[model samples]
Target: MQNFESLNLFAPLEKALRELNYQTPTPIQAKAIPPAIEGMDILGCASTGTGKTAAFAIPILDFLGNEKPRTRAYHPTVLILAPTRELVIQIADSFGDYGKHMKFRQTLVYGGIRQDSQVKSLKHGTDVLIATPGRLMDLMEQGKVKFDDIQIFVLDEADRMLDMGFLPALRKIVAKLPEDRQSMFFSATLSPTIRELAATFLFNPISVTVPSKALTADGVKQSVRYVQRDEKVNALHSYLSSDKVDRTIVFTRTKHGANNLVKKLERQGIVALAIHGNKSQGARQRALDAFRDNKIKTLVATDVAARGIDIEGVTHVVNFDMPVEPESYVHRVGRTGRAGAKGIAISYCTSAETKELKAIEKLIGFDLRVENPKFKFGESAPAAKGGKSASGKSQGSRRKNKSYKPHWQMKGRNKRRSKTASA
Candidate 1:
């Protein structure tokens, strides 16, 4: 469908769409909504930020609206499973936005917080239940939730579920879902393993595939800066110092790395926060709120922690650590350049990370331009092929300068660098 109006959604949904200024349907939405509204199972392949939330949410809302659900405690008519708490929350927000004019009760269930409120919310009756796998499993084991009344089952970020080792939990959850319910499976990639898993859940499903380019939005300008392992923090600080950067998310490979990076940035006088599995839900939420409100312009996060975060006005994404998984590179960069807005993705790579960089390049089908830092921090050394530095200095000169200390190490350097490090 060219527009949401052509989809023939419920009256309230159409009204909500108009108010939200959602005119044209995204590729996944255009292909998935019609069949979904017709009660057919959908197997959709699309990346984050492609409006897939609306693709499945709208049809589910339409179904709930058309057929007034018989509310029952612990029985949700729609069960949407996402890989992370942020994504579950994001999906719930989308549902609320799209179904604002329609009356529906939805509850979010996730771990890292007391379950008292979530349990009470479930007992009070809800039309939709959005949750992460681990918490949902706990609730199921405790007999606080049920799948008997589920009319629609949605498994979003299916590939991520596998990456996080949620297959066993997924199978158990799917077993509880009624066979009569309509199912929808969405993932960034439709690999053989994902397809095999989807076959078990969906019957003769309609497959909707968004083009591969959608995974890496066209508006993002991607580049890499080769820095020594010890100088990564300084290199990142320099980039954050640039006036071009606004709201940014810096991805790290480990939770400890994320925390350390935040501390380093703070030492540089750049107020930043870290989010990872180690953080309490309250802490993560607070960090996210600060970022969304621009109270803090930068957030350092691990790959899993930052998954499913859909925020606007993110002008740049920095990779503080190269991700071992190429798929994660796509996810990290996808955080920016959303909603047709321009974005920049910069990665810091050391000599040891060249293998990971090559893997990422092979996956993206292109090479990232090696950007020379304005103030070199020992990244000018020649690679295997050998080349001169950006300053026309010989490889030998670049080597001789490797021991050269930058402003970060000088007696009065940090104080001076702090002035230029404000992000």
Candidate 2:
């Protein structure tokens, strides 16, 4: 498929994709791109790491090529909206890489950094804009950025946009755009509200989903151990000590827990890193990069995939703690088994977390092979008398009705948008 080429695609894109080792088109890409290039509204439903970035990006880059800039004002010709600061940065970088052959001017906006700098980036009149809903809306409110001229508008990670609490801001921003324009929405999973929100923007969209995310990517081998609450760290130690896991990301429920886990690993003479909300922005980037570059062997984080991290070759995703929500399990383990590479997700559960474990199984629609670890393959989490069942009510569906507030609250403006969207 490396030899495969399309007339609409420019020379630079072909060469860049080859360099990155992207050969054949994934199902999501093969189906979504043609219609997108033809100016059709697209609703892409693929799980994380299905090359969704390039799916939307290749089309946008081709559409906006050689189009005059939006003058001195910050009204973008191509606006890519994402849910988190990490995603914002990643999309910007993707634009840069994909459009390297062309003179594509782009900028990114998110809340972690100073707003003044972002405003200045807009003043230069970028052609392509990637941003999170909050900072983008804030800039629009200040009259620093405009959307009247936006020709291509994309909402990447659509479900996540709702999860991050950006529905209100998304509606406000979309309301400001020209009613007739090419709009696209991409997400791992779409709910009723996401559908309602998409209807308000997308015109006759083509919706597509890669196979069931629950099927567990063919490359990944999953297993679980029902250890006592106090025994988890030791079990994880055993796994790490075996030399099987070259790189690892341990997911924990709380910010403090992630940090403590990293510290504990260090005390045991294993250097590691932790990334969560409380850490400074610089620290998070450093930790992620260090792990990716193999400077650090272990990295711990909270369950936010928006952390704009795409570290290739992640061998194992250890659920140091099982997620409270099953939908979250998709995003958590998703950090591994990326880009069609093989990976593993090992969840360490105690009787207390049995309900959470069962909830994940139900949502994924299949029972994960719960192994005793000590015995062999295809074993189940050990049964103790009256212990909670690993099969319980799915939690993914339960968290769907949430109202996510953007990380950055704009004082008076937030209340109105929040109320309307959540209501």
Candidate 3:
């Protein structure tokens, strides 16, 4: 119930919040801003659209505004690291929005384009530098950026960072930071691994956990449709063709799958864009911008590409392929139903993916409502008639198919090979 004014933030920050029409503080913001402004380290567990960005950004801006720290060339006072370029860009944008009234210079450092501009920005001096690990490491090696003067450090989407195998780079970067700096670690889930990771960066940090409802797939109308593997594209196309879908993001398991799905949708007269790791930074940003502006209503992306992206008014999130990890299911479904808005998450599940679906169900602590949609573009009936069971065998097959593996696991094994293919 606390408001931004009650947090007693700097006058400039309070003015900016009011101009942005931000009145009451979210749970994470309410709990994190007070101590964060007091120069306390924070360990926060919150998901996208929970006002997590403001939780850290507000405090950092307030501190910078009040102290009026000297901006050093190649040495930013505040460092914020995210897992992907999209996330890094979004974080920088959040800082821009929240720090509008403050007198501070901020720059972004990420890969996929060129370092000349980023290098120039660094040389010009910056107060807040937001970057991704890979490009930041490259810059660090070339002595383009330094962390010697860092006053505040934030690692947003800590879980995603670890998932993308950025631990070594994170360790190297953390080693360069000043021990006297205020560290804030934010993650979607504070698993044992995350807790262990936070222990290394944070010093006597105050832990803030958002209510469980915000972390889970709450406020979303979730449903599962049983369909054969071949029917997935048509089923998805049918859904997209409907008038109800507005600003939908389709999740595919692989980069190739995302591309293929986009092609299929385009052939079906649907204008959709695909984004994955293989896409360049510019391409990803263009697609994200198009989606945000409603220039494109449908966007197909892999889990890795879509993580930590906060786009409002997403009406639907279609799971063209179920995520291999149960935790990813929560992240995928969370794309919609954000900021107290009602959303629909439709997951298409084949018999081979039943195990994955069950894992997701177990993680979410409830069953997804089964939906049986009548076929329109297709030539036949629902998947239930003459369909394989969870065992991935025909109805007449009595013998156990011991060689069966979940679709997601099968995809996992070929990930190394798939890496070489374009998204």
Candidate 4:
């Protein structure tokens, strides 16, 4: 409970943890690892940056490393199913790092690339297999993969799998696995839908929830700017130019929005790359590698593409477009302020998005600070007559007759007005 050493992990695993500089167990790890080591099915509710991967990965490695090797041809001892290709790769890397001193063979398979390499790896035997649901199903249908030898089955990001319409595939995959095996379900948020799905797979699972005071990471400082719809790009440019923003991830609502934002940033002499579902796996990986290696300062992405991205030294997260789902905001800002490092989350909100912002605030149970000086608290347009601010307080009470004059709008107002009139 106090440290990883106290968990009685195998010597090799302990050594690997020390090599990875994992001195203390995170809250989720501290609670979930013990039960997981006991061979009990685990239901964990933890977000991306909370070290949940290690909570599950360490116990599995410790158990498999000590167990006798099964004489199986195409079957793996452990199977981890994730939603995104990025997550599948990330989880595979964690297993490799944790099992370095052991003789655990692991292979990861996902879509968006040739399967010849993955098939060749599967032709040999492996102790661990990590894969995305779609490719896993494809390989299974071809009889190239087997779960007969599986001792443990892990469903990582269960909610994401459902969100991406993998529920049917997941059910089909789970039906093939031996019901006698231990199951582990880990996700950021466990809704009723996820719970029902878990019930079908896990047996008397030990539930663990690492509660946060706020949905966002503790190290992230959150703020918002009241900018007009058209002026968001300028505001983002201004913020990124600051010295405080070393490396940042800018979240947009749509894939096109992400690409367009990158273009706009490039025109202004700011270098950035965009990642979305449409990008090939190689392209997405290249952009992520550039950002991680510090070759690029900013990476533009949509909510779906940004999932499972774990990079260090990310100083800021810019929400170019507020997400309709409040839970997504938590995941967006979570890209930064990771691994106990301090980071900042800034949201650009326009008048049209006030309702979405309010919904996010209500979900998070706090008011985001309005940090833009040009827009006074009561100076902006009246919030829809009966609407409320993100704080759940009445908007009419905060409305004022005074008009706001943004600095950017003042300079080109007449020229823009003339151009519009001429058109």
Candidate 5:
């Protein structure tokens, strides 16, 4: 459909869309919304930043806004289960924006904060509940939450929940919900495991898949740089200092690594922050708020922590550490290039990570353009053959025997030589 008006959404939701200046339905939104509004179970496969939040949110709001009052005390009519606290908050906020003109009530509950407020909100009851799996289960067991009144259930980021080993919890959550409810499952990629879970939960679901050239968003420009492991920080520093990088997210593999990188960047006079599993919810929210407000130029995060983040205007995404799972590369780069805005994804791959890079290429069905320190953009790196570079050097040999050094380190060495000569 060309516009929100064409979708026949509730007038209030249409008004909200007009106020927000939403002109067109994304591919996923276009296909998913129609079936969803018809009260059909929907299984949607679309990447992040494709307006997936609104794809499901808009229809759910419309359904609730028009339907008669079925809401019961301490029981929500609609339940949304996401994988992360950040995403739970994002989804709740989206509902709030779309349902502003309606009187339907919604509240988000997640871990890492005192549950007193959430408990109080639950005691009074709400029309909708957005929550992470763990917190939702905790409340369910304590009798503070119930799914008997739910008419609609949504599982957002199903692949991510599976990756985080929440399948068991999901099974428990699904078991608790009434079998006679509309179901919706959304994920960036659909693996066999995800399909199996969908089958177990959804009944005769209408499937919607928006296929792309690659798993990531079309607006993102992806590239990789082969550098020594120790030089990644320096490469990131250089990239952040460039004018092209405005509002960036640097993904690391570990919480400690993210914190350390933030410290190193701060030492260099860069205003950066880190948000990971280790940070308190308040701190993570603070960092996210600062990033959204443009008060911070860089936000370092781990893959799990970054999953639910939906900040806009991020021009660059730096993979300070390559993800072990190839699918994660798609998610990492997705942080940028959202909503038709151009985005750049730069990955720092060390010789040790050739295998990881190859796995990513195999999954994405294309080789990423390789850029060395001396070259802004170069030809695609030849695929590693049998854990060896195309040049017939073993991965270990490339890491240990290659004599090439980073330009910045060489420059420092040259400065030392000049100082000795002058002395």
Candidate 6:
């Protein structure tokens, strides 16, 4: 167990850690902070809530201390690239908390909104710049920005960098950065591309792994339920109605499904909200705000909208529709069990979705605790009750649907290549 005082972090960082009641270093933080301060590039593998942000942020802030004079445009001495706008905002907020007492200024630039505010912030000369690939590249091409002066480059969510189809963008952005600068990358999963990036960017960097190989948060208790496709809603309704549920996030397959689930839950007297790509950013923010503030007991979201939601006290995550891609299951359940709190992830699987369940199990390298809820209408056989059946034989097996909407999916097709060039 490493303590904050022994780490020899700068006063402001140590003070913030103390204020945040961080007396002991998490496994990742314990291994990450020291070497990073010594000007070594780092490759850290850790889950979402295992204090990864602090592990990198504290070290980067210390490295970027108030030595350089302020510039007119936010020159971004420390560059942190994130996959999504929500993640960019969250990282910037964490930076603000730890770097407040220091004389450092940080700015967050991402898509999903107008660029006026971001451009204005850039003109004011920020010391640290946290941004997404698309928006940052756009700003650069518009002749409003450049990464020529960045001394430190941090790539957060390396798995997502490849997952969200941002590998090319990341390569382009990294190409523009000074090759001599320090480089670091953090992610829950280390794909081959990530390893290749480490070789291409870092110089003999110490590799750090916390609770090493675990894809999802250790604090999250994962389980699954076998149900018919039509009965997924029924199972979810039952789970929410139980006295055990406090706060929950329900993930659906599509935007329409998310909204429909919310409406279904609301009709059953369960207070719920939905967030998706089709909704206006204001509406999405409002729903997130309500969920975070405890005004909404449950939030249903599509995969895209679920990426950047950093809410605490999320008691459980319900996968109403299973994700075909195995990695997505890890990210979906990661919403809970954050900030060191225990949480639960319950996935609903149908007969047709069995392959996906098996794929997820293979990816995680563990079998989920499977539960078959005893339904109230258990004995009604379609053929026994005179209802027409395709197979005609009436047994305990109930028919189910096979197809689901994975409007988008992770293309984890081939192994990431080594010896990366300017793609």
The lDDT per prediction is 0.88, 0.75, 0.86, 0.85, 0.83, 0.78
Model 2 misplaced regions, further than 4 Å: 1-4, 18-23, 66-70, 305-308, 373-423
Ranked by lDDT, the better of candidates 1 and 6 is 1
> For each candidate, what TM-score against the reference?
0.87, 0.82, 0.87, 0.86, 0.85, 0.83
Q: Taking the tens digit of each residue's C-alpha lDDT, what string does model 1 give over 1-423? A: 788888777899889999999998888998999999999999999878888999999999999888988989999999999988888888988998999999999999999999999999999999999999999999999999999999899999999999889999999999999999899999988889999999999999999998766768779999998886666777788889989788999999889988888887898889999999889988999999999999999999998889889889999999988898888899899999887899999998865677788999999999998896563543343434345543334555544686766444653764444334321
Estimate, for each residue in 1-423, the C-alpha lDDT of model 3 and write its tens digit: 378878777887888889999998888988998999889999999877788998999989888888989987898999999889988878888888888877788889888998999989999899999999999999999998999999999999999999889999999999999999999999988889999999999999999998555555567999999886666777888899999888899999999989988987898899999999999988998999999999999999998899989898999999999888888888898899887788999999865677788889998889898897562222333345456643344644433467765445566654544343312
Best by lDDT: 1
Relative to the true structure, candidate 1 reaches a TM of 0.87
lDDT of 5 at 28: 91
lDDT (Cα) of model 5: 0.83
Report the lDDT tens digits of candidate 2 across residue range 1-423. 222275347667666776777667878788888888889999987765777788889887777664444445676788888876677777778878877777767887877678887788777777888888877877887888988778889988887778668888888888899988898898777778878888888998998778656436778877777775555666777788777788888888889988888877777677888887778667777887888789988888887642446778889889988887787787777778876788988888765566778888998777778776464322334545545333432334433546633325443564454345333
By TM-score, is 2 or 6 better?
6
> What pairs collide in candidate 3?
none
Error of 1 at 188 (Å): 0.6
Worst 10 residues of 6 by lDDT: 414-423
For residues 182-245, could you state the per-residue lDDT of candidate 5 as single tens digits? 9999988888988888999999999998874444766888999887555567668888998867
Candidate 4 regions with alpha-carbon error over 4 angstroms: 214-218, 373-423
RMSD of 3: 6.7
Q: Worst lDDT window (10 residues) for model 5?
A: 375-384
For model 4, how big is the CA root-mean-square deviation?
8.9
> What's the lDDT of the predicted structure labeled candidate 3?
0.86
User: Which pairs of residues clash in candidate 1, taking residues 3 or more apart in a chain or in different chains?
Assistant: none
Q: Scored by Cα lDDT, where does model 6 land? A: 0.78
Pairs with steric clashes in candidate 5: none
Q: What tens digits encode model 6's per-residue C-alpha lDDT throughout 127-237? A: 788998989989988977777788788988887777778888888888889888888888777777788877876788889986533537678889988775556676688
Provide the clash count, candidate 4: 0
